[model samples]
Target: MSFISSPVDWTTWTPVIPATLMFIVKDGRILLIEKKRGLGAGKINGPGGKIDAGETPLESVMRETQEELCVLPINPRKLGELWFSMGDIPDILCHVYRADDFTGTPTETEEAVPLWYSLQSIPYQRMWEDDIHWLPLLLEDKTFLGKFVFEGDSMQWSHVETGVAW
Candidate 1:
């Protein structure tokens, strides 16, 4: 079988926007949000959103968690990064994080409904298709960097690099 390659020059293509995704863990359970609106709506995902101008990825994750889950993530650690692309679509550069501690209560918000699931039972089928490829590595405490090209929600190509977190 022949392989299909993206037309864009990934080596030089820059992400048009920066985003964040933070998964908070406690007692082997992970915190997830069922998005109520906007992109990836109705799907289960970590609490995070756009990295505002002049804000670091860490700040963006913290702000998004507070806005979407009503809690302050504590001791968040960098897990990895995911670079996404689609033909003619804007690119998204996402920084993924993991937090084992937090302050305040996690509650339902206008943006999402907070829920927890066993780490072993993450609902991958209900998340973006690319998640299954890299989430497992993160759960295993391995840091990773990955890139994916997609046509809508369907993944067309992907590459990942795994290593121990520094």
Candidate 2:
């Protein structure tokens, strides 16, 4: 199938503002999930989802983690953001967060299978392509924001910055 390019007039493509939560550890370990269904189905991702109206990015992250993994995240720090765009398609404003400590054990929901992996050995093959770009910074204890262009599941290019601290 022919792909739709970005820069398409704002008349098409729905807006996708997704928020993600990554629980980080000192040894480079991170919390991840195996998708149970939809879109990025079957791939691994941090616990997160669409940000609802009236909820801050942090609130969304916390809610999503609780809903998706049955865990209560503690003090989620806003590490960075990603403005995903391609051609003139649409925009997915993603705000990323990190919180290694939390309450409760990770459990599966209808959305994902909770799991963890060492930072040095994250299963990148099972995650969205863009994750490999900025995940390292977060694991390094540095906060940053990133811009990425993706075609379905592959990244075309990326631009990032160590954004101001929150």
Candidate 3:
């Protein structure tokens, strides 16, 4: 008998954890990217991308922003971290950062089209389902830590509540 007769199984779903950086301004506006393809295509999100190996979160954010938006975020602070799982694809453990200062002009890259939106006027139709869940806390200068669930591109639910904030 052959000792190696294990069947190959390829049916599995897991969340993809990508390190992301969100650029924020004192004007309560956030820079977002309109995805062109894959996952939330045509949807809007912060300028970010996957974290490379042996790279820190800050470094990853800088590189990703330059590659995708061609902008440099300045004086950003490490605000909080979050864990999100949509279906069974990959769990996204995002380290959220805030930048009250930044420089350079954002350019539209292949992955996204750069745009800015006020917090209240955020285009929900263009964002992931869970974005509405904890985004408010972010705008209020509150550090956030939470988990959210989503089915495909729509957020299913969340159990998050920020105590108090600025």
Instruction: Provide the TM-score for each candidate, comma-separated.
Output: 0.93, 0.83, 0.80
Root-mean-square deviation (CA) per prediction: 2.1, 4.8, 9.3
Q: Ten consecutive residues with minimal summed lDDT in candidate 3?
A: 1-10
Question: So what's the TM-score on candidate 2?
Answer: 0.83
Clashing pairs in 3: 13-88, 14-88, 14-89, 14-90, 15-89, 15-90, 15-91, 16-90, 44-126
lDDT (Cα, tens digit) per residue for candidate 3, span 1-166: 1133312111342336767657666577778889887656888887676788888888888877777788888877766665666564677767777787677788888887988887678887667766766677777777776566556766555656465231
- In model 3, what lDDT does residue 129 have? 68
Write model 2 residue lDDT over 39-138, tens digit each, in one string. Answer: 5889998888778888988888888889889998777788887677654445787778888688888899999898888777899888888877788887
Clashes of each: 0, 8, 9
The 10 consecutive residues of candidate 2 with the worst lDDT sum are 1-10
Q: What is the alpha-carbon RMSD of candidate 2 to the true structure?
A: 4.8
Candidates ranked by lDDT, best first?
1, 2, 3
Clashing pairs in 2: 6-86, 6-87, 6-88, 6-89, 7-87, 7-88, 8-88, 28-119
Q: Pick by TM-score: which candidate is best?
A: 1
- Candidate 1, 20-135: lDDT as tens digits: 99998899999999999988999999999999999999999999999999999999999899988866568999999998889999999999999899998999999998898889
